[model samples]
Target: MPSLKDLRKRINSVKKTRQITSAMRMVAAAKLRRSQSDIIAARPYAIKTNEVLVSLVTRTNPDMHPLLRVREPKRGVVVVIASDRGLCGSFNQNLFRKAETFIKQNRDRYEDIQMVLIGKRAGDYFKRKNVAKRAVYTIGTPSYELASEICDDLIKGYVNAEYDELTIIFNEFRSALTQVMHVDRVLPVEPMEAEDDMMNVEYLYEPSEDILLEALLPLSLKVFMYRALLESAASEHGARMTAMESASKNAGEVIGKLEIKYNRARQSAITTELMEVVGGAEALKG
Candidate 1:
């Protein structure tokens, strides 16, 4: 039973909240657009890189390549890509759930597990587990430099036999309203399942095919990491946009309800004043 003053104040507070939520929705939309465009632009390069790597593998003995080498898992590392800030529904939560599944599934195989978190949310989610080796959290857009830095350490670890398996988990951007969680094996690059139609690719090389592979291996792995970062960034933007839009709609509904309540309270106050005046006049006449 709030008075008129309280009702008015509440209405004003809700209006302010609605304004903030609306603004957040707009900002998220803009960021989502930019992130989607970035993904589109990077698609060609990533595709081309994969095609080239596939062609090279077909021409050479993949067994000789270090990245193609596979062995029994003794230790494993998982790279997790999530958003630094959350206001984004269940994006981070879903990813963490998947990560937990991954860890549980691998626990029987790997003697030890390591975590490399790409965002703050991921780090926080696993902080209590004591598995995180490193975390890179950024406020700005995800960049190639960050991916490269992360992959560098991963590559070094694999080469040094620090870990026998490496994988990455991230949200894959599908559309404005859709995102699919992806778990990609980054080490011992999974063999191309089927032969490409253009398999017989011939490239004249000054160095031997093995030498070329040595150089391309690192580049290819870097591209894979970069692509994951890009996808995660785009997904984050999309989730944030969707979440903000929903919040804005909910706020609108709340404001509507508050408006109704305010009107009722104000009307009740006016009615009370009118009844008091009539009673006073009747009393004076008597």
Candidate 2:
């Protein structure tokens, strides 16, 4: 049992911590709302882009463009996206684990496996392991410019034949309390099964199929990257918000428990003092 003074001090400290957690919860909630909206707006654009790409690929020959060329992947790259900060429960850890598992499983197939980490947390983790080929850091918040930069590097790598295949690993936003880790191939674009269904549709290209494809392919890739970054950002915000809300609730519970302890300790002290006073008066009467 702690002394009344010690209990009071502990109660005060818990109250301070509870205040901080509650504030963080509110802040995270606000951010999550904005992020969720952005993600909702971007989803349709991404889906339409993919549908167009599928239609174009099905109608065109595979040899028409270099991006559509698929060959045995001798070398590969994995781009991992994670948050720079922690305290979001298992958001970063889940992505990292998925990336690591992929590398380990595919080690035998690829002669070289390179990593491009998007966030400080993922970069640091890969760097400590001495496994990353190139890592970009300090992408404060995921934005179009940052995604464009990453897309440029990935395009260069694919064009230069640095890697035959490129994959991206990140968390996809589902809801405030849910995020699903996903690993998707980003380069040497795979032909979709639905492509065949779109092949019969009549369409006209502005210049020609070849020229339009040349321009559209790269832009599509950039858009895809941007969409991924946005999704990941939204997911991160949601995870943080959910985690902080839970923390705030837990903190409230802890404060309640501490307050009860403090009251009990103070009561015990008062009872002890009263007993001493009563006994002393009786002895005086005797």
Candidate 3:
């Protein structure tokens, strides 16, 4: 058991911590709201882009566009999206574990493998690993410019035959409490088979299929990268908010317990003082 002074000090410390956690929770909540809206708005455009790409791929030859050309599994690149800051619970840990598992499992499939890490956390995690990092970027706000820059590099590497496969790993925003991890292939865009009814119908293209594919394939890939960033940003904010809320609750519990302990200690001290005074009075009277 601690003295009254010690317990009181501990309670005060916990109260201060509770205040900080509560503030962090509110900040995270605000950020999450903005990020959630961004991701929600981006989903529709990303989905429509993929739909259009599928339709275009079905109509055009796979070899017509560099993005559509499939090659043997020789070299590969894995793009892992995490976050720059910590205090987001297991948001980055889960992603790192998934990326590690993927690399371990696919070791024999490719002759060479490299990483493209989008976040300081990811870079720090993989720094001591044996894997090579092709590029490492610190992620901030999700923007088309950043996405385009990353997509261009990926496309360049793919077009140059430096890598045969490219895959992206990210957390998809579902709700404030839920996030779904995804591993999606971004390079060598797979062609989907057209339905029989759609196959029979002929549509005219303003430009040739080849020209249309060239314009759409890269744009589609950039859109995908941008959407992934948005999802990750929202997921990070959600995780942080949840973690801070839990921390605040735990701090409150600790403060409550400490206060109880302090009250008991103070009462004990008072009782001991009262007993001493009563004994002294009895002696004097006697």
Per-prediction count of colliding residue pairs?
Answer: 0, 0, 0
- Local accuracy of candidate 1 as per-residue lDDT tens digits, 9-29: 887887888788778878878
TM-score of each: 0.94, 0.91, 0.92
lDDT of each: 0.83, 0.81, 0.89
Name the regions of candidate 3 deviating beyond 4 angstroms.
195-207
Best by TM-score: 1
Predicted candidate 3 versus true structure: per-residue lDDT over 99-176, tens digit per residue: 999999999999889999998999999999999999999888888799999989999999999999999999998887
lDDT of 2 by residue, 174-263 (tens): 888899888999678766566434546688776877776777787788888887787788888888888887887887888889889888
Q: Where is model 3 poorest over a 10-residue stretch in terms of lDDT?
A: 194-203
Superposition TM-score, candidate 1 onto the true structure: 0.94
Score residue 230 of candidate 1 by CA lDDT.
Answer: 83
What's the distance in Å from true for residue 153, model 1? 0.4
Candidate 2 has its poorest 10 consecutive residues by lDDT at: 191-200
Q: Which parts of model 1 are misplaced by more than 4 Å?
A: 132-139, 193-196, 199-201
Instruction: Evaluate residue 199 in candidate 2 and report its C-alpha lDDT on the 0 to 100 scale.
Output: 45
